[model samples]
Target: MSNFSSDGFDLDAISTQDNSDVIYEVGGGATVIQNEEPAMKEVEPSFNTSEHDQCEEFKKQGNEQFKIGNYLEAFDLYTEAIEACPSKFTGEEILRLKDEFDEKQRSEALQRSRLSEERRRKKEDEKKNGVSSSQPPESSKPQPFKTFELSQEDKNDKLAVYYCNRAATLQHMEKYNDALKDCDVSALLNPKYTKAFVRRSAAHERLEDTEAALKDAKAALELDPRNATIRKTVARLEKIEAERLEKLKEETMGKLKDLGNSLLGNFGLSLDNFQAVQDPKTGSYNIAFNQNK
Candidate 1:
């Protein structure tokens, strides 16, 4: 009724006056107050965006996208983020995104890998398993263990297999000494390897020697653990300790036999005990060869 619209009271002026009399008008008249600070948030940090920070940004963008419910895009973004983070950042906070993303990725990757591996393995396994196709055979995969018999090639192959398999088993058994020997033999047979080293590392773990174990593990991991046999070996070692002391002893004995054979071969397989008898005329001992046949 006081013509409120006509005056349109000076709100700004009122606010200014209120500001001045804030303390006075209240019980603490004319008192000074500390300034109110702005609330901090999970905002992007101000540090220079290095490759690591850039990766963080990618992860952040992914998270932001996820919040907006763009799941696919978020996933892709996170993938890029992880890839961008670089190997150096793997064990770092920068790589720290939602564990769900990683777990999802790991599950997906493992699933896909398993699927593909299964298919390929089946195809290969079918050859051995006799799960022939409906049609006649197009070709055949060479057997993994086509080794010869009682020959150098055979020994080499058997030794390799023995070492590789035994190394795997021993790793599970936590038999470091024996497992390491098998690994050494595996490598000797075929230097290009990851399985043996990886298994050997597991054996080292059983012995509670992390340093050497880590070294071997890293080396083996650096190689291919995707192999079915290698993966199986790893999996076996994961839950149990598999040792082959008997296998090792057999291998050692075989090697010793081979060594002895080689040495005897060099000497024409003869161990003749001979003493030099003096030749009276020349005052020199004649070489007497006592060949005990």
Candidate 2:
């Protein structure tokens, strides 16, 4: 005899309830939540870390690498620092500031126009009434214009330093043109930066632009007279320039001589047939025909 109790207990009903409960739990449970997917936790977006702080950190790393003569690494770090820099305000903020500036400028312009009109009217009235005086009318004290100072978003000093350092790295890598561009940017940012000028001079020297090199070296020397390197650089560039000019002069004279010889050959009278003799008194060369070749 099987031990089975009828007792109105349906096993099928219990199995069905079990399956339904499992499905409901997996499906997020409860009749109100039926057919609904599991709720996902709302995640708030994280704000970016301070750009100035990041830039400073990268700059520090770059300087360390530069000191170790790891130029490529230093350049990369410097680039990252530059990219991380928040040099300008957001577009919306800039627009708002510009609007305010424009409004203020418009108000000032209107005021100036009204004042000019009033002055013109007074002048005309005086002229009509024959109120001319020998002495010039008392000049009104000039009003002090309002000075508005806008806050800069980036650290200009740091940026200039980065550019100057990067230029140095590029120069060491023999990338003269790239180095020169960086040096230019550095100098524009900080006009008093002597190192930028010095680096720029080096770049020009490598590019064989002796004149530009000398100019920058002189500027650098003026800024830092005690710098022996700049003095030596200036001397070297001047010598190079002199030598280059002499070489160019020789080349030009050689070309002219070649042309003359070619033309003389066409006439069946080569340059060898002519002898130039310097007149002792006049210091001028006189051409003498040579009968014997």
Candidate 3:
């Protein structure tokens, strides 16, 4: 066996051994050691733990400020968190992180299934005894195995949340357009995040873009069907959208009538002289000329 050293294996010991040809150092500062097993390449960590922690601290401070209705202060802290967050990985680094994330997710799924099975067994035992246990149900939430080590995917999630929080702050500040921009970033970072959709819907509604607001509200409602607030928002937006469309139709028809009256003034005719009748089956309108009118 070869003994390990700071630089590498002890070359002096290898020279005395019968297997001298098995190991040798190459020139030009490049050392190649031949062993019974293949060497493993070290993967560099994708995120800086210190930076991730700092980001989390800032986010927590922001949340506290938000709870007290200090929206401007909260926005500033959330911005700091976003600035301090881990930069995204690219190329091979990102691919390796993704692989690790997928593996962890599979492990978490397996753990969740096992926990569910245990809960089911406990329920069956309680049923057999004809006695309900006072104990609370086991939480089905799947926790990642390690706490200290922050994965690249986790950092990404935190960054997304920071953006969403800032968006909420901006909404409170009455900066609807700026809020919409941050909401866009949050949604892009985490497409399944329901709050991003909700925030964006509110921004659109504030800007009087009822159609866009309704679309985003519906998206949020789709993601969280059981959320009473989101369901109510969807219903409210739908009503507002219908009323808005009716108002827009009335305005457009009024404009068209005004223009028609202008052109007909030279011919002693007005829009009132012609009546538009809608065919219910075809949903088409027919204009009837009535000189008596």
Give the winner by lDDT.
3
Number of the candidate with higher TM-score, 2 or 3: 3
Query: Which candidate ranks first by TM-score, i.e. highest?
Result: 3
How many pairs of residues collide in model 2?
A: 0
Q: Lowest summed lDDT over 10 consecutive residues: which window, candidate 3? A: 23-32
Q: Between the candidate structures 1 and 2, which one is better when assessed by TM-score?
A: 2
Sorting all predicted structures by TM-score, with the top scorer first, yields 3, 2, 1
TM-score per candidate, in order? 0.24, 0.54, 0.58
Error of 1 at 146 (Å): 34
Residue 231 in model 3: lDDT: 77
Residues 95-206, candidate 2, lDDT per residue (tens digit)? Answer: 3564677679778867877886787688888899998745466445554455333343222445566676677667667787888877766665556567678668767876
Off by over 4 Å in 3: 1-45, 89-155, 276-287
**Number of backbone clashes in candidate 3:** 0
Clash pairs (backbone) in predicted model 3:
none
Quote model 3's TM-score: 0.58
lDDT-based ranking: 3, 2, 1
